[model samples]
Target: MADLGAGTGLFTRLLLSAGAARVDAIEPNPEMRAELEAALAAQVAAGAVRVHAGTSEATGRPDASADLVTAAQAAHWFAPEPTVRELRRVLRPGGRVLLVWNDWRGVDAPLNRAYGEVVAGFTEADVPPLATRVPEAELPGLLPGGFEKRLFDHAVPFTRERLRALAGSVSYLPSPGDPAYAAMTAALDRAFGEPAGGEAPLVYRTHAYLGRLDG
Candidate 1:
């Protein structure tokens, strides 16, 4: 299995836990790969996993080397044409590519609304979310032979600090050293204001697409 754009190996860990015998976790960011390697040290030592610095457009993996390829919440940044071709070249004849997204766009709740408003306000207004700039569903259309999609309700337990951490993790949001970072944290802190039992739901819908590209 090949895990592309495997940020901090979150999905890669899931794949391993789900019994994917062997996995090549491909991440482009050195920092994230470092964290992934540290977290999966035992797995690496046992040959259960290997971490590589690579991108979705150029994985540097041998042709048709994977039985399964997955990208979670990372494809939005990929150049679609190269990404499609790369996935095709990386997978074996019967291999499948799975794209997963945990989206919060349309959740109808007060806390979620406040959180969204803050993020939108905090980011560069001129630079829109890639999902808004282009319909994300179009990736499925880009698949040579279409794909199957499934949507499930997904939620995360949230607290003020966790909310701040989650916001910081987003690629577009201000990082810790940015001028707006503290302000963004403050806004998130207010949005997450005093939940019963000190927590609330970070609601989302998990959208998954699975299909084989034409051999």
Candidate 2:
């Protein structure tokens, strides 16, 4: 199994826990790959994980060798056509491609709104439209092949620490030494201080689209 864009190995850990005998994690960003490697050290030592420093466009895996190809939140950074084409190339006959994302519910509740505001502050208005944008409504056209779409609503335990970690995982957030980073941290602190239920879990609506390679 291949975990494309396996930054920090979140889903890579999941894949290991879910009966995958081997996991090949492909990551492009050097810093992210470093983090992933650090996180997967135990698994790597046990020979359960392999880290490939690459991206989905060029996974460097042999043709038709993978049983399953999965892209978690990283699919939003890829070129749809070439990515799907390459995914097809690496998948063996009857192999499957799975695209999954954990969409945070940010607009519904008070605490969620506050959290969303903190995130919105980091958005760069001038940044160009990204090459890979996963719009739920546009999934069908992106693949050009038969696919199955499924939605799974799940809650992940949320703490101020976890929230801060999530924020750190995003690319748009101000860098550690940047002036804006202090302000963002201040905002998050203020937002978390308000009276709220303790250890309340945040709901993440996961969208997964799976397709069989047309071999």
Q: Using lDDT, give the best candidate's number.
A: 1
Task: Tell me how far the alpha carbon of residue 153 in candidate 1 is from the true structure, in angstroms, after superposition.
Answer: 1.6
Per-residue lDDT tens digits of candidate 2, residues 1-215?
99999989999999999999999999988998889889889988888999998788899998987899998988877777778778888888888888888777533655577777887778677643332347766665445566788988777777776677777766777766767877887787678764444565667778799976462
Which RMSD values do the candidates have, in order?
A: 2.6, 3.4
Q: How far off is model 1, as Cα RMSD? A: 2.6
Top TM-score prediction, candidate number: 1
C-alpha lDDT of all candidate models, in order: 0.83, 0.78
The digit string of per-residue lDDT tens for model 1 on 1-215 reads 99988989899999999999999999989999999999999999999999998998899899989999988887677787888798888888888988888887778866689899999987776665654322555765446666788888777788887888888987678999899999999888878788534988878878888876773
Q: Poorest 10 consecutive residues of model 2 by lDDT?
A: 127-136
